[model samples]
Target: MTDQKKTHQPQPPIAVSPDEAARLAGIGRTTLYAALAKGDLPSIKIGTRRLILVDAIRDWLAQHQG
Candidate 1:
């Protein structure tokens, strides 16, 4: 496959840290945690860490972007 194709390929279960998730969501870490605590954000427990699916996040943004 071409380099561009590789770079453009869909990600499978993108894992992000709390800090990175906050940055991507345009909120502070505290706010991110607050949402998580309130069960407002989508997440899954992977092993010991909490993970947010990239497809979920993308769809969320698309909804808001419209």
Candidate 2:
């Protein structure tokens, strides 16, 4: 009997840094920040770092889509 090793796939992050969120959303950092500032998008701040939820980014984009 041969034993096979199972391969694990990496899961996507639930939250990401602002820069990464911007890249994932296909928007400029400044635009992303503006949305965050305007309360159009939600983010969480830990220490001095800001993180945006991946789901929030997706929902925001969907809401703004023409």
Assess every candidate by TM-score.
0.60, 0.93
- For candidate 2, what is the lDDT? 0.96
- The ten-residue window of minimal lDDT in model 1 covers 4-13
Summarize candidate 1's per-residue lDDT along 1-66 as a digit string, tens digits: 656543577754476767778778787889878877877677888788888766656665565574
lDDT of 2 by residue, 1-66 (tens): 899999999999999999999999999999999999999999999999999999999999999889
**How far does residue 46 in candidate 1 sit from its true spot (Å)?**
1.2
Q: In model 1, how large is the Cα lDDT of residue 62?
A: 67
Q: lDDT for model 1, on a 0 to 1 scale?
A: 0.72
- The most accurate candidate by TM-score is 2
Candidate 2: list runs displaced more than 4 Å. none
